[model samples]
Target: MITITTADAIIHTLESPEAIADIPSPNTRAALQAAYDAGHWELYEPPQAEPEPLPPDWPAFRLALLQSASFRLWSEALPATWREDLKLAAIAANAEALQSIYTHCTTLHSPGHTAATEWQQVADHHRIPITF
Candidate 1:
């Protein structure tokens, strides 16, 4: 099992401005700052993007979230950027691996070989690491 032992720490580290500097767009910055300032946030819903397919354990993970008040509250309070990041991460992950990554956010670990790796399995794929 690919477990992320310190997901909150990893979220904080990845959420740093310096970490996501290459995402582009001033809107992203404003949105992220607003979420931070308010101490509450929601996922971004851009028209062009869509949620990825879930893996085997997705239902279990979702059930866990629904069953846990803490996770529900925290997830509800997540910033838009974080939501978008989650979506992107989902897009970059395998259908069978989505639940582990999403539910294990607090653990901070990412899949070793995922959609991103598969998409970028060639020299030409380097044009954009940010594109899902």
Candidate 2:
């Protein structure tokens, strides 16, 4: 669950400042100003770590691959030293397999089912990458 904070609330409210007179509290107002200076508000409580994604059944695996861009913008921004640490290669490989399956198997057109099935062929030796 997400816990939004006083700072987040105040900044969001600042879009229309004309209607309100005094802002809530000096502390909250300061936090809001600080957040604005830093570019965004901080979460009151950071989000709980998401449970890791299970190795996709074949079809689901296929879909994520098909959706990945040739050069993912998210991954590209990382420093070159950290590129391999990102572990996008596994994702790219899975995507390639999915695309191959789709191109080869004329019959199974559903992205989910097809991806899952193709994944089964690879599941024994390799596990999917898990990110924080």
Candidate 3:
């Protein structure tokens, strides 16, 4: 079994026939040619794909989101009743309330929305699943 590097080199040399002369070993060249003729170039094992990353730490994310300046500002800007309701929902860890908040922030183009978007992008880039 050849290493991945050797397999790649073989494939490259086969594809570029002129490069075959550069290969010092006659046996290696013959093997490469035979493999190519047999359409077995891909018979060599491929590199393993990277594993999918685990989801972000939900509790930590929630805490950070709740404590964010954007969230604070959004809450402060709400009417008295709505503000109280939002606080209660947050305390209760209501999923619907969180979704509602996200929707509202997005609709209003609030700073909270920007913060959420940034956080989401960062999470995606790090291969972390974003629950929110």
Best by lDDT: 3
Clashes of 2: 9
Ranking by lDDT: 3, 2, 1
User: lDDT by residue for model 3 over 77-122, one digit each (tens)?
Assistant: 7666666665565556565775576556445445544766765654
The estimated TM-scores of all candidates read 0.24, 0.21, 0.41
Q: Mark the 10 consecutive residues where model 2 has the least summed lDDT.
A: 102-111
Per-residue lDDT for 10 in model 1? 27
Regions of candidate 1 where Cα sits further than 4 Å from its true position: 1-56, 87-132
Candidate 1 — what's its lDDT?
Answer: 0.41
- Of 1 and 2, the candidate ahead on lDDT is 2
What is candidate 2's lDDT per residue for 1-114, written digit by digit as tens?
212234445434443322223556776556655555555633345459999966545444435544555224433544553444324444465545444433433232222444
> Considering only N, C-alpha and C atoms within 3 Å, which residue pairs clash in candidate 1?
4-107, 7-106, 7-107, 55-95
In model 3, the number of clashes is 0
Worst 10 residues of 1 by lDDT: 1-10
Q: Highest TM-score, which number? A: 3
Q: Residue 82 error for model 2, in Å? A: 39
lDDT of 3 at 37: 58
